[model samples]
Target: MSDSGPVLPWLVIRQDDNGNRYRVGRYATEDEAQKIADSLHARGRHEQLYVVERISQPAL
Candidate 1:
C-alpha cells in the first residue's frame, strides 16, 4: 500500500476579541470555513464564533 495520507485542510479555532472567550474554525476554502461561521451566526453566536479567516498557504 502506498504510504500516502489525504491532505487535510488546516483549521484554527480562536476568538476574535481580546477577551478571547469565543471560537472560530479556519478552513482552507472560504465556503467550508464560512459554513461554520454562518452556523454560529444563525445560532446567534457570531461574536462567540468570530470569523473564519484563511491563512495564506506557503509556497510549495
Candidate 2:
C-alpha cells in the first residue's frame, strides 16, 4: 500500500471576550493555518481572540 495523503489540520477560531467559538477552517499546511490565525489576531483589535490551533496531522 502507498502512504496516506498529506495531513490536513483543523483550524478553529474563537473570540475570547464574548465566549464565541467556532471552526474557522482547515489547512493542509501549518503555514496556511497560521496566516488565518495571524489575520484573526490582527482583526481582534482590543478584544482577545482564541484559537484551537492544531498541528498538521494525518487523518486517522
Which candidate should be chosen as best, given lDDT against the real structure?
Answer: 2
Off by over 4 Å in 1: 1-18, 21-23, 46-49
> Per-residue CA lDDT of candidate 1, range 15-42, in tens?
6445674445546566776777667667
Off-target runs (Cα >4 Å) in candidate 2 are 1-7, 50-52, 55-60
Q: Would you estimate the TM-scores of all the predictions? A: 0.48, 0.56
In candidate 1, list every pair of residues with a backbone clash: none
lDDT of each model, Cα atoms only? 0.55, 0.69
**Residue-level error in angstroms, candidate 1, position 28:** 3.8
- Which lDDT value does model 2 have at 12? 54
Candidate 1 TM-score, true structure as reference? 0.48
What digit string (tens of lDDT, one per residue) describes model 2 on residues 1-60? 237565566575766677777777777666778788888777777676747577554566
For model 1, the local distance difference test gives 0.55
Q: Which ten residues in a row have the lowest lDDT in candidate 2?
A: 1-10
